[model samples]
Target chain A: MLKDKKNYKLIVVEDNIGDFILFEEYLNEKIENPTLFHFERFKDLNDFQDKITPDFDIIFLDLSLPDKNGLDLIIEVQKISKQIPIIVLTGYSDESFATTSLALGISDYLLKDDLNSTTLYKSIIYNIERNKNLVKIRESEQLYSDLFQLSPLPICVYDIETLLFIDVNEAAVNLYGHSHSEFLNLKVDDIFHDEEIDKTEEIASKIMTHKKKNGEIIFVDSRSNTITFNGKKAKIILSNDITKSLNHIREIELQNQKLKEIAWKQSHIVRVPLSQILGLTQLILDDKETTQETKELIIILNNSAKELDKIIQEIITKSKEISLNE
Target chain B: MKHLFIIDDDAVSVLILKKMLSNADFLETPMVFYNGNEALNFFSKNYTSVDTYCVFLDINMPVMNGWEFLDNIQTTIHPNNFMVYLLTSSTSEYEKSKSNDYHCIKKFISKPISKEILNEIKEVFNSI
Candidate 1:
């Protein structure tokens, strides 16, 4: 089959010699562009598992294999790969048998008596297509689950508007310290500061206003606008815990407040001494209004006053260092 | 002359609504109530008149909710004379759908009624 074509590989796990020949003739006579294999017992699965890479598109299963009878071996075969579609071919065609087969992830079931070459061919191709879709769906679920688990940002999806938490990721559970069930029970008020939550309707408005998960308002200067937590809208929220970033901002703000205080002192308190000096110099010049010696002394006093003014100006100008000190 | 009623718990919100509606010449004068029960009581006493066309209702007011007021008025008074518009800050989608469950409520308007929404009110009244 590999030498003639590059297509799906099929595994037939039927113990009956007659049924094995029938599967072969169906592929050879009824199926076109198909590759086939037949087995008498469950050992062939292990044998094939060792001899070749397990990449069969379909596993045509018989419930009564020589050694492995009933639904157990079909499940064992199913564990191989959900992508490898297992269609059970059974003489025992009952609802219970079909139910068990389906519960065990057998893609479909076929009755051996009704197994014409056409039915076999159609079943093989149909199972192959079903297997492809199953694989695709599984891949997508895994990919999304991977993102939900590993993404750095905390994310959760809830029903829209009901705000009932539907699905939550590991990051969301970690950030909010909530289990999936616990998150489902919470409302918009549970996470926020109670006084702040007096205005929860406002937060919902903000969420609706900035539909992007990233838009934020300063909660405390140290707060990030973008933490997604439990909202009752049954909305999905993806929040990144920026509490650390917010803390850094608060530290800087406290520092800035300190600097602004220093700047105020320099502007007013520090300049008070210069004003006293200017007053003293004016009074001295006023006391001896017309002497040349007094005039020289006044010039000296003026220069000292200017120096004091410059010092005050420099303190005011440089207090902006509070910004850099952060 | 058209008479409107203001049902709000917050004094400031009711004051603003009254002052704004008066300035807009939207009514002769809107009667004000600080809670849903007071407004329902006023309606019980005054339901015989047909001039009250609008009730600017706050949903979270004490004594009774906006939904309860609608329910009470159904048995206690005829709603043919007045239409209630829910101007609330609640963004709950459940609340939006549940409002449809009440037969007397014409529409649920969200909070902080901007100029566009108040203008829509005028359009609804002018057609009458």
Candidate 2:
């Protein structure tokens, strides 16, 4: 299928002329970038640095460009501009290198073997669509900030380096008794409760942490992710207020302990009669005994069996009493 | 001479427990009580005569149960520090916790109390 006819201004940053021609042949596009730069060596990349433009919609990168190998070149490219969607082009042998490249903010990777006219077009379409979604997600977060002014579960995302709140959902404002601007003024640890964190999990890994807000400690469980928030590197965190549920579970656990204590008695003393029945049944079934011995065994089994029936009745009665009180 | 008491309503159980203690050399003479009430009655009558160090008790019984026996133990002439080993087929959680109530009770052995359980009893005896 033809691309959803994107007049997308694409910049091709590959060093190999053969691969570049193949990329064009693969895209089957008659048109080419007016500012397409070619470089087989690292010096060529430095020479053409300022020649890059802001209007470029897609960046096709080659990891093994002679100036640098692996992420060195990708970092150099990002040092230039990160807003444009990146599509990595790598030969099959260096295919594994694409994942690291992608993690470093490359948008997509195209296997040289899988590079067909259709695939190349599809990659471009998908990468552009993904970029569109990211922009929309950010826009939605911004446009709906006020509507979240009093959300019950307050959420704040901040930059790792700046320790500055990038944004707080509305629930955070009401929970902290702070306005959005007030939340923005506080660091995560300022209102975090030590007891709450200890009661919960120690949320202190750079991956997680506890902070105090309004004389109360809040737990922050965060995932280290790469995102361009406010045109700078930042973190996105989803936080939950667990204070109420924490105490609620503690009471339930105590009740469960009491039930388990009784359940313990049921397991030990209660099953004694049943197990005796089973073991005695085994003894009677063993044919290596005399008829007289078997006769005595049957008598013992009958008495234990009758005793167990009575014990079950007593247990049922006591259990009903416990249940009724419960 | 160390004399231990065995309380079990079943004759076979009493026999098995008797053989186990005898083989393990638990004491010079160990008395048998067919039921908890019999043992309690024996204890009531004995009062201060015999030096009884241990009592092997069964939980389920007619007339009076093991728990009732333990309850009566608090009121009896049976002195403290006499550990009770619960020889029972009970794997009940309640029975295990109840074992804690009788400070005199050392351990609960699940049945059929085999030679392995006999070994465990020996180990407890050796430790004490």
Per-residue lDDT of model 2, residues B1-128, tens digit only = 34577788877676656655666666546778877888888777765634546778888888998989888966764444466889786655556787887777778877766666676766665555
What local lDDT does model 1 show for residue A217? 29
Tell how far residue A111 is off in model 1, in angstroms. Answer: 1.8
In the range A1-326, model 1's lDDT, one tens digit per residue, is: 32224365777888888888876776666544666676787887766665434466677878887778776786677666444677887775554786677876678988877778778767877877777787789899899789878887766665545545567777766666767788777654344442333221323222211111233322321112233434434444555555567679889888889887877666644554454455445444544455888778887987888786777667766765654565
Q: Among these predicted structures, which one has the highest lDDT?
A: 2
| Segments of candidate 2 deviating more than 4 angstroms | A1-6, A29-35, A41-54, A142-326, B1-128
lDDT of 2 by residue, A124-224 (tens): 87888898887788788876665544455555666667666767776666666667787787665555444233322223333233444445654444323
- TM-score of each candidate's B chain against the true B chain: 0.86, 0.82
Fnat per model, in the order given? 0.00, 0.50
**Highest-TM-score candidate:** 1
DockQ of each: 0.01, 0.22
What candidate 1 gets wrong by more than 4 Å, as runs, is A1-8, A31-37, A50-55, A92-96, A140-153, A156-166, A179-253, A281-298, A311-326, B1-128
Evaluated at residue A66, the lDDT of candidate 1 is: 72
